[model samples]
Target: MLQIEDVLRDRGSRYAVSGGAVQGRAGADAFVAELKRVKKFAKATHNTWACVFSDLGPVKADDGEAGAGAVILKMLEREGLYDHIVVVTRWYGGVHLGGDRFAHVVTAVRAYFAALHSAQSR
Candidate 1:
């Protein structure tokens, strides 16, 4: 798995991103489960994620923060990433960020991609 922690900080909210190769829905679920096994992620306010499978198409979860899953899904589709799931976990800081939240999610996903690419290059 590739993880980029503290990818973004806006207002009082903090975001982290993670991703890994997965097979199908079960694989995605397992990946999420593994992520939540960490105490910090398990307590996060939201853990939005998305995946595009070559065989199964796209799957996503907002985990409470609405529309975030779609944002991640679109990024995966745009990048032509298949059989891989990307997660953006947010820790709310009691401020309603409105549209800024979506932008933050995008930044987090991009950070994940950068980290993944950097890892693969090594």
Candidate 2:
């Protein structure tokens, strides 16, 4: 786990992105287990998540965020990250963010990737 947490502020919306690396490939059940392991995100309005494993390929859930899973999946594909799951928690600030929401998701995943790289370096 990389212990990544970042808050993205855009268009009056606050997105808290966090994630962990599972060390090995994880399937859908493992992804759900990971979500349950993160107690902090359980009560969030939306726990949008995505995970990719070398063998399992990729799987994601928008958690009602709509198209968020695809955004995360694209990032993972670009980075070539495997056996990792990222969760973005959103707190709506009473404003609509539109496409900016995807940007926030990217911001969150970027933070996670940075942390993951740092951890691997160490």
Which model scores highest in lDDT? 1
Q: What's each prediction's TM-score?
A: 0.97, 0.80
Where is model 2 more than 4 Å wrong at Cα? 23-40
The sequence of per-residue lDDT tens digits that candidate 2 reaches over residues 10-116 is: 65666776666664443455755666576755656678888787776788889899999999999988998777777777877788888888888888888878777
The residue-level lDDT of candidate 1 at 65 comes to 94
Q: In candidate 1, what are the lDDT values of residues 11-118, reduced to their tens digit?
A: 899999999999999999999999999999999999999999999999999999999999999999999899999999999999999999999998999888888888
Q: What lDDT does candidate 2 reach at residue 120? A: 81
Sliding window of 10 residues with minimal summed lDDT for model 1: 111-120
Return the number of clashes found in candidate 1: 0
lDDT to native, each model? 0.94, 0.75
Q: How large an RMSD does model 1 have? A: 0.7
Q: What alpha-carbon RMSD in Å does predicted model 2 have with respect to the real structure? A: 2.6
Candidate that scores best on TM-score: 1
